[model samples]
Target: MTPADLTCTVLGAVRRAVEEGALGGAVAVPDRVKVERPRPGGSGDYATNAALRLAREARLPAREVAEVLSAELTRHPGIAGVEITGPGFLNITLAHGSRDALVRDTLTNILTSGSGYGQGRALSGQAVELRHRAEVRAAVTADAVRRLLEAQGALVRIDAYEDEAAGPVPAPTPAPGPAPTATLAYEPSPVPAGATAHELHRRFGTDATRWALLRAAAHDRPRLDDGLLVQKESNPFFLVRYAHARSRALVRAATRLGFTAGYEEDAAALGDHPALLAALGDHPAVLASAARLRAPDRVARHLETTAEAFLGFQHTVLPVGDEKPSAAHRSRLALAEAAGTVLAGGLSLLGISAPEYL
Candidate 1:
């Protein structure tokens, strides 16, 4: 299920629980439920602090509150095991096949619609204005987010990025022979070999503005972003990067697989250098938190789906194959490293760990 689906289901339960008067009105606040990954093998795929949150209001011990909610939540088909832990947390595990299917569904959605997928109607009447980087990196995935949202019918407005195009530089002549194609299986028309007209226009430059126009039209408001997107709510990419960076295997494997996933230059190459300190200078924590949430899908119902993506890259579903580690590959890998660095940096802003070797 998408994040919205989970929230809706949880809210429904909370609303009903409140109506049932089992624990009074205040204890049923679904928004209070905080979800995240349980330590490996910790009892569930997704864990929530819902019980603990309602403990005081319900005038019961945290564990007792947890037990009550666990029983109530299980009535929903999607929820499998609901274990009580620590003081009074609810560690929820979705049914077995659910995760696998969720992943397949996400991949199918992403592949079929690409940037256009996941655009929703719930947000049809709403609007979000975004402040994105100018001449954005072709490798950057946030560009896809606007499309995903629009695909779902939500109105999205993107602020104009700087006009100057930071067209990717021609990598020094790449190795002659075609590098590996054994590992090719992802999205957004991978960057093609250089010397082109499309290269002249920044993808961010075009798409961001295009998205803004669509957002204004969809939401029926021009200044919606100024009012809606809000102050520093943050790019959802932060969440994606967080998960990948935190997953030791995901990070290391992504490094090897050339998933150079960063917002700037490759992570390894940019380390502790005197130059970059200025580039990253003073980015805020709120922006960092959103980035650190492990791609926002983390251990939630969406994790099974997210994990599969990493697996695909790790296993060479799109193999680097035998392309002699060409300049293209190096540049691409550096891009991936940039992603890792950005993800880790995002988490650090949120007070989370973005391990280096992992």
Candidate 2:
């Protein structure tokens, strides 16, 4: 299940607990709840602190509230188990076949929605204005932020910075209410070793130049070097494009073997490939988070991670030699295709191309 699904499930459990008086009649159920990937050293696929939030209202210990919610959430079919960690956080594990289900769902959504698969309403009904300098890096960063905000259902206006347009900032902000609007100013990161964008593009080409500018956080300087032009695994850009190309190549090979990409809810199919499955499943969340944070670098980093996972798992997607393709191969192919879709979509958001052949 996606993080959104898990969030709803957790909220539902809270509502049920409150309705049953288990959390006390006066206890309030929030309109929403958060469920996120577990932090480092934490167990389970996701974790929530809903119990801790409700503990105060429930008039119970945090751990006690966690226990109550744990019992309630355990009944959910998508959830395998819940563990109470450190005070009251609920660390949740999904059912055994959840990875397969996620793969199927991700593939189907991408096939249906294509470039819009990860579009969300997180910033719905909001208006955002972004201002940046005329430098190529600044312009590119502003453009990417515009895309991200628009994807999250915001009406975005982008403007290049102008000295004449600069004026004393307004004192009073808009009153707090529904559909709040925001204005953001972005400062571009420094160029690597004082190299100009024209120089970088001349040396590395457009895609590599964009990737070099975007792969690093805004606070971090970007590098423009021969390394970015390398066509080996050592080059992250190469790895991402190579992985997408490899995924497409796998589809052709499977087609020649008379099998097409398909999905089956077989837990064993994904048993040995948790990393790839997790990366695929996390795509929507990554996009949403990146949009919310105005961080295209996050998406860039996610592509690299997804590419590495897919590359490691690509060798097993089709028959090795004389072996015949089977249902397992089809399912694996579908998963790989989903990864490619994610990579391509992310690259598109970063204003980069994902060539069919690297």
Report RMSD for candidate 2. 5.3
- Top TM-score prediction, candidate number: 2
How many pairs collide in each candidate, listed in order?
A: 31, 0
* lDDT score of residue 201 within candidate 2: 66
- After superposition, which runs of candidate 2 have C-alpha atoms over 4 Å from their true positions? 97-100, 161-193
For model 2 the local lDDT of residue 59 reads 90
* CA-RMSD of model 1: 17.7
Model 2, 50-168: lDDT tens digits are 99899998899999999999999999998999999899999999886664566567678876777677877777767777776646676677677777777777766766654322222
Q: List per-prediction Cα lDDT, in the order shown.
A: 0.40, 0.79
Candidate 1, 178-235: lDDT as tens digits: 3323321122222221322244233223322222222221214222123222222132
